[model samples]
Target chain A: MTAMTAPQTAPAPALIAAERVRKTFPLPQDHGGVFTVLDEVSCAVAPGEVVALLGRSGSGKSTLLRIMAGLIPASGGRVLSRGAPLRGPNPDVAMVFQSFALLPWLTVQDNVELGLKARAIPREERRKRALAAIDMVGLDGFESAYPKELSGGMQQRVGFARAFVVQPQVLMMDEPCSALDVLTAENLRGEISDLWQAGNFPAQSILLVTHNIEEAVLLADRVLVLGSNPGRIRGEVQIDLARPRDREQPRFKSLVAHIYTVMTHPEADMTRMLAEDNAEVERFRPLPHARAGGISGLLELVVEQGGTVDIPRLAQRLRLDVDDLLPILDAAVLLGFARVVEGHVSVSDDGRAFAEADILRSKELFRQQVLARAPLVAAIAETLRQKRDGTMRAGFFLDLLDEHYPPAEAERQFATAVDWGRYAELFEYEADQERLRLPEPEAVAP
Target chain B: MLLAALAIAAVLAAAGSGIGIGEVGHVALLGLATFARVVVLLAVSTLIWTPVGVAIGFNPRLARLAQPVALLLASFPANFLFPLAALLFIHAGISLNWGGILLMALGAQWYILFNTIAGAMSVPTDLRDMATSMRLRGWRLWRDLIIPGIFPSWVTGGITAAGGAWNASIVAEVVSWGGATLTATGLGAYIADATGRGDWPQIVLGVAMMSAYVVGLNRLVWRRLYRLAESRYRLS
Candidate 1:
């Protein structure tokens, strides 16, 4: 519904758009197939609005940003810049990288003038514009300083100056503040907000990719939440709040909470977004990056709170961001030990039992939960049981998982499965040998 | 001033030892020739390998294959080819002067390639992506991004290659194939010739002169460039 509402709300055509875009990278090994990063995902940034592409890691938000910038090509579909199919690098966009990707050898002024130099602007004019951009970012005296001499915040100011110097139609920033310290990040965020509010920002529109939900609410006119595992747009929320938004405002807090809920319910959102249901893929999605101990810790906390808690409030109480809390919540939900309805998380009866039980009883419950709900761990146990020696190389399972996940993600999933399996006593891992074996019958008991 | 003092001490010591002043002068002249040969060969090696290394380093696929091959080639003892090189010079009537430069390059060029490859590889993906998003291309990209990105690595390579060339000169300046020797008019040849005749004073003078040149070059040229690389060109 919000996706449909985008067209009616926008006053102008999109400055940049991805039309049914799909991108795939070659599998790292010789599997002879591709790994899909973005699959038929489409979003747009029109003039006069700051659009945030928000997602956790592996959601391909950055990849999508790169595609829209024409830094990399989409395997399928088109990236339209000013209503034309983009070719090579998009000439009308500039980017601020999370790394503050300034040339270390160049002075701040030279770094700011780089885009102008690339465009073949005359050197004197280039210097004047670069100096002005530098002044605008409050980096006037830093013009002669190299990036290494600057602090992270100062370096990012240089990054902003470089991007603004180009005066492109769309300014693309990839997690622009995520790499800074919390205090510095907040400071930069406020300054960026101030610049946007001042109404003299050089770019006509802004596109930001970030995993920080509060950041999206604070900065974006409309936030598009991206889903991972072959990234697709899961949901879109239009932030109707005016600029210079307050984080403590009821509307702002609610929007942040709503986006957190949408991000956590991957399968529910996917089914709603697509016409056909692909339950198998959703069921076998890679395990969340959470340990048994962490999941138990979260369950105990929820139980202490009377078994039901609003996710955002719980995150705030724990002083953890949604990104940190979501994975643990996802793991607990995946094991059928918890359920999330709306933005509130309620521990299931099994979760309460696991949280209160003694260590041995907890392991028994964990073993049952993992075997019944975790397909990868169950498959490993089953495969090891069928083997003559009751053992298999870890690579065999990794190779199997490579078809569904990227190599790094596959490796992570296998490691998580190993951790859970070992904790449940369903399987034993030989660290040095990289082999997995079923637990002996006696060891499996208790 | 320090180098000049060392050179004077060496010349006076050689002359006082009853090795004629003319002989010490000749040895000093030969040191200059060998130094010139090393400088020229290093320039040539850098010119050829910097671009090739940049090309290979920027492409991950090519770098994976070429890196090991360059290492393998660098490890192969260049002396094993000296006899063949000598025969070619003899047959083609090429002077040992030119042949010596080629022989030294054979041993020294790999340092540049290796360092350049590493430098190019170390150029951050973020910077390259930034350059791409800015639409920096061709010459501007090279000037702004690629060159400075790899400068520190290239300087490291240049330093190593120059050292390798100096060491290679002792063998490369004088080559022997099938009982015939081709000797270039350089300090390496002078040392070899002195050793053949049991002329210890001349040999000492030649070694001292060669050492003086290597130390002077390292201190004056390579050190400054290395400081520049560390101070300005380094990626944080």
Candidate 2:
């Protein structure tokens, strides 16, 4: 990618550097083995640069951001802050969160002044600095309001103020707008980009972790797509557009389209990716986490246009980024309903029929497809039917799934199975009791 | 079990073997002494536990070790501890006044410990990450993040510990160890003495006074603190 050859404009100082950062979560009963989350992930943010990590959910983008913030230690490799190896949380780095993470007990002024209070700043100076920071984040009048009393966007403004009050060199944001309404999110995004462009923002550089393709192109100078399953950088695209880039422009639309392709390119090589481990993994590995509603939603959309449509056009029509669209696509592919060929998604006959059918008939179709294709779901249903009690512990299936995939991913897939299986009326999972029971034989058609 | 005893005592009073209305003042004065003891015991236990409970709460390994030991101590029965306490303090002549408070505290402190542990463990990880990114560690971490986070739990612990201290004072006040006996002048001692001598009037009076004191304390004091914790310091 041209991102690798971006010229060194006066060799800007590196604010944050993540070199081969790897994180592994320990398994409960895997003895010495561990579940690798991020493997050999490397990136850096230089002065005047904004890099975005674009990927699907459960892709370790958030974990990578936390590593950059020095909030958590990597299992292997190192993170450097301001050109020095960082051992723990560094004062020069800060983060904004998806949840805002403001202290609900504290008022906005106190929340904004949190870092200053921790550093033992004198009371008078702390108040002045906190207010200035609050005003900078456009939260001037809401200083005395409690976090619970503020809107979601206002609360996040407090989050931004708290991070900026410390004047961090590298500011890391993990899905900062993911929790807000579109209008509020767009307003805040415009405000942030405006501040950064006018040289009014305090942070030297920002690393934004988001799954929105247009958001990545609009906000960052470089975009990196993190591939799931031991998240690694699969592709990088450099955005060369100028400030305040128009979305209606042909170039901006093309850049967004190009990223969609790069993110999905790995799916074609998925068999090769699995073959490196074992041939059985391609078929036996647990499915990606997706809901029946999401799968059906994608099915209905794809089948609407005579059961065939280009993906880029579908994405444009649906306004879904690759991250939001691909899970449903993967679910369809896993269920034998649709397949992606070249740049187009073509719905199978069954998918089209299911889309046209009413509720009961569609569920019947789903039940048939799931029973035929998903081994874990079929096994669960069979075990429940054979047992006199008509129930089995969820841990049994979780352990079975773990034999094929990493523990956490296996757990996610098992949860997805429970959702789809329940939707298809094949099995019912009681989360509180952790039991899976067979569906009622005399179940109503509805 | 104790509340049931008090209720049965209430029914007996309605059945005619009740405390005479004239001796209410004397029982009220005695009730004051027992109430004073409960306060002293609660204050001392809170002082010790607020630190230790909070420390154990923040550390998982320490919390695991603390759980079984604290449970054992809490359920050990304060009456059993008084014999050892009386023996230790009799020769030094400190067994009469402060011995009751010390014995009551040993039973009550665990309420504060376990509840505080639950609160500290639930202090959301995102908030902790905020602390780290803000470079707040060590003393700042404890004072700013952990302390305020545990306030609601502390209020809950304090209320339970206060009630448990009152229940404990009956056995803890007039403790007899081996061949020796120590007595403190409080409603707990008065009731124990009355029950021993079969004085129905004094027993009813004492039970009624204690019920009054506990109900009054719950409504006038602890309830307000509990509401404050729920409204202002609640994690949600």
Candidate 3:
């Protein structure tokens, strides 16, 4: 970043400027209506400077780059070059796509010469200029070769040559290295940095779009992070860390971590809120008709009534099948409506109020809990529902049970089952495993 | 065979001398001089046919007009025109030989002209665009860009024209009408006599000799020109 700062004093005027660009896409009525993909995003690139537009998928980084390059028209804002409104693709601005759209029929030299020839330079002069540009991209000896003869990286270099040969004032690269392998992308990035540092021949400024955070951190003097769900600029982070950045260094990691933390905090807070609300709802819900058979059922009943219930009292309320109701109470604690302290199960503060709530409120809270935990049970439920041969590994079945119930109860429920083979297809554990190997459910047959 | 070869060679030489004297000679001269005159006549005819071939190759409009016109001109019996041509030229105080030879060359020139136009029109579109973007326009464009651009077509047209010109010379050299006759000392007159007398061997010999010359010239010259164009100038 110190290396990047040296050129900041006399930063050139904005070569390409976009103001309040908004791109909205209409959705089918059935798909929740219209959505805005880019909302009033504005950014500028100074001449001879490199700026990275960093965003996750669907953040409109590529779209904004296209608009700036005049490849696409912005719906609501103006893109200006040197403070003059851009009408169409200007010769002073050249764009390289990630796909490296090179003309297959032309040799490298002729491809480079395309711009020169279009400008009507004399033949001898065009050849000389095209050769120099081709050499600059390090494709000197491959001048006579066609595009098919070059690798992905080499072809991209040719694309660079084609753009650079024209000596455009601004070069717009749309994820130029995204399609390449890691090492190739790194090499190309180094080459680009070197070129920008040298500042030869028209001295182009670059506006690049990428999803790679480290790439943005390493290359750009400033990285703009866009927020999702109708993509808009969330914040801009200035990386003052010196160039030739060490990715392993504490400073770099902390910066990345800081960005990540800021971006994810909203989602985290929402999850916590939903969990608390569900716990409240569960505590207030009225007990369903309970059969007087097991201590497990009595403990559930006591918890549903918004009362602090102990395992010993729960065991006395219902005739015991097991030595303790501790496992059942533990399972209830894990489900988040009750807390276990010493030997007693009690409603959590949120859960106690929820137990006395109106039915409608309880139902809404129940729905949220189910929806929140749906993904946890979805895989096992799908597997169980689709069972054909009636044999599933026990481990997978136990895992799903453990997610919904506490681990010890889940184990006990399996141990007391009437027909293990009937549900064997729902699990992943083998019958041969020592801890899980049980008498056939018929032998225990209770 | 020897007589037929010598006779055709002698007529070609005479045509060359006709072209050497001046502008009129180049366009209007007739009769024999030496063996080198055959080579000179061949060279001169090639020059006249070059642009005509190119125009026909590059310009569809010219080719459409020239194709049928050439066919009609080539097939028209020069003998049928002999009486009319003789009376008209004699009355106008013009030489019948020059008029007759000019008619023969015209029939031959069309083949070369049309073939050249076909070849030029067929040069690939990308190549045409490359030429255009290089700012090639007008006559220098025609010289450096268009002419070389259509060389292969020119060769095909040239070869076909050479055969047509040889055929045209037969009726051109031997003219007979109303008991007035004019003969050029060439293979065409010799073949005419042989045909009149039903001499099969002489007819066979004249055709064989012409075939040999066509084959030799194509292999030694036209083929080489085409190879250069295909390898160096071809866009693909």
Candidate 4:
């Protein structure tokens, strides 16, 4: 067998590039704060290639296309065409809207001639070019017919003829076939493909936005899937399936399934990384502080005296905020070490039985001791860091403490009247008098 | 009356020969029928003309041409020209009754022509474009598009022309000149003679017969044609 060699072809440069683009809207405070509809998204389309931006409704795909077209400005980032920034709708770009925006009073020939007329082409030449474009779209004899006289498909063909007459470098279709019936849409697609292959038109690239996944798969060189809730690029699937692709092929189904999985399960693989990060953080930090006793020793003090400890009371005793207390409680709940119900916290029956009966292994005892010491020790370390050799300003110190530690812990650790009073009076702090009065030192310290 | 009928029937038979509607045998029958029909047709046309003429006068385009034409014809005082009509008929060696019918026909023809043209000119732009885009041009365009486009005006003009013909008939039928005088026995003559003798019953009968013929012909023909045109041709 003869040695094989790859075919030599010139590489096409990127014609359109969108980098870290974002669009957002300020929501009414009544409806719940500012809502981001599109977050930072990046995409690029090469010359002569067709790319389909696919998404469900409200996914910001059309907004992105509009931004790329320079019809609207993006709230963040930039879109560049041929290494130059896109400012507004360029003369080299033409867009076909879903509604065929043909002027009713104008005949097919006049509608087709609009773009050239706008450019101030001479009348005779404009007519000639208009007729040629009309003929190309197979509307040869309908030059004088007005929009109302034509069928829907024929009207869309007039729209196509209008766009084609301009000979723009980029043809952006905003769901051009969505309004047409399937057969008409298919015929239009075929006509578009044929025209592109013929290479007579100036439109070097086509960028289509569509909700139909199969349409994207059928028409695009690459399909970009956008996900909702602050829309971002979920995945890009290269459609290497041969041109004139069969939608019935198993390979196509597999590719569609892959896209669906990427769109639906965005955080599937992220969960493992998140869990690993949590483990590493726990390994480096010292354990939480526990009372100087084993489970039985603690049980004797609380249960033997018929005492109670819910999440809030436990948080109060530990001098921790509700937010900081929640993760620890969640972990404890997950491990079956505690039970919380009806805003009341308690040890589970199994937890109580285990505490009383378990002296099973020294390692198990050590683990429980570490778990109990973690929160209190972390809070103390944060407070020390805030104190900073006693040189930090009091107001700054409280802010630092609040940042690092929970509100309850900050309140307790910095409870001195002199410390809080000077800072509060400086900032005009409003303190809850009943819950957090300055302690009388002689009464509290002894 | 038979002589007037025979005269109109000869003219109609000659005209009908072009369209192949009849031959000589039909012409003989048409002579009697045409005479009676001319009298009836004249009376009927008279009653229909005034209301339809007013409608035509209100039309924008036709009113410009129709106002002057109708006024000129209506105020011409055809009755004063009986001696002239008689002298012409005798000098030309044609029957006087033939001249009478021709004069009546000319008076009616203008109403139909003006109204028809006005309605045709009033066709909307969209419908015009629809016709053009369909490549309707020339005679086909005239027959299929223009004729239908102005049909209501044509009907209106036809009704007005009918009345004009009746009004013309009185002056058309009576004639007097030096040593020559002629009169055809029709409703117009009957009305003239009754009025001359102050015969109320005869005058009332002539007027009543003419009014009945006008109402009957309009209800039977013009109304139905107008309904069809309004339904089919007039743009909403």
Q: Which segments of candidate 2 are over 4 A away from where they belong? A: A1-13, A29-33, A267-273, A276-284, A310-324, A341-344, A348-373, A382-395, A398-412, A422-446, B1-26, B59-69, B72-78, B91-93
lDDT of 3 by residue, A1-446 (tens): 11111113225578888888888654422234345678898778887567788776557788787677665578788887888998765556766768775655568987777667667779999898888888998988999998878999998998888778777877777788977987898899888876766658444677778776667777776777775545676666677777667778887765655444333334432554477576433332211111112323443477575577543344446643111343344333433445655335676644544455564454344333332442332243345447665345667655644543335544554443312222222233344752223324453322
TM-score of each: 0.90, 0.87, 0.42, 0.39
Give the Å error, residue B1, model 1: 13
- The full ranking of all candidates by lDDT, starting with the best, is 1, 2, 4, 3
DockQ of 3: 0.03
Give fnat for candidates 1, 2 and onward, in order.
Answer: 0.95, 0.78, 0.02, 0.00
**Model 2: colliding residue pairs:** none
**Which candidate number has the best DockQ?**
1
Tens digits of per-residue lDDT for model 4 on B84-105?
Answer: 7788887887764566665566
A47 in model 1: Cα distance from truth in Å?
1.3
Q: Put down candidate 4 lDDT per residue, A207-319, tens digits, no spaces.
A: 88876666777778777877654577777777788666676788776565555444434263245336656643433222212221333343433344343454334444655
For model 3 chain A, give the 10-residue run with minimal summed lDDT.
A284-293
**Candidate 1: which stretches are off by over 4 Å?**
A1-11, A266-285, A379-405, A426-445, B1-25, B176-180, B194-212
Candidate number with greatest lDDT: 1
lDDT of 1 by residue, B20-47 (tens): 7787777778888988998898889888
TM-score of candidate 4 versus the correct structure, residues matched by position: 0.39
lDDT tens per residue, model 2, B5-65 = 6645655573566444446667678779888888887677767776788778766778879
- For candidate 3, the per-residue lDDT at A390 reads 32
RMSD of each: 3.6, 4.4, 23.0, 28.1
Candidate 1 residue-wise lDDT, A1-446, digit = tens: 22223323255888998988999988766467788899898888899899999998888999999999998889999999888989988888999999999998789998899899888899899999999999998988888998888999999999999999999999999999988999999999999999999999999999999988988999999899888867988888889998789998999998887887778765654465365346556444679888889999999999999999999899889978766788899899989899987788999999999999999999999999998888778888889999999999999989878876777888999999999999999899998999999888887774
Tens-place lDDT per residue, model 2, A268-362, is: 35665656665345445456667998889888988878787777789878887676678878778778888776557889988888777898999
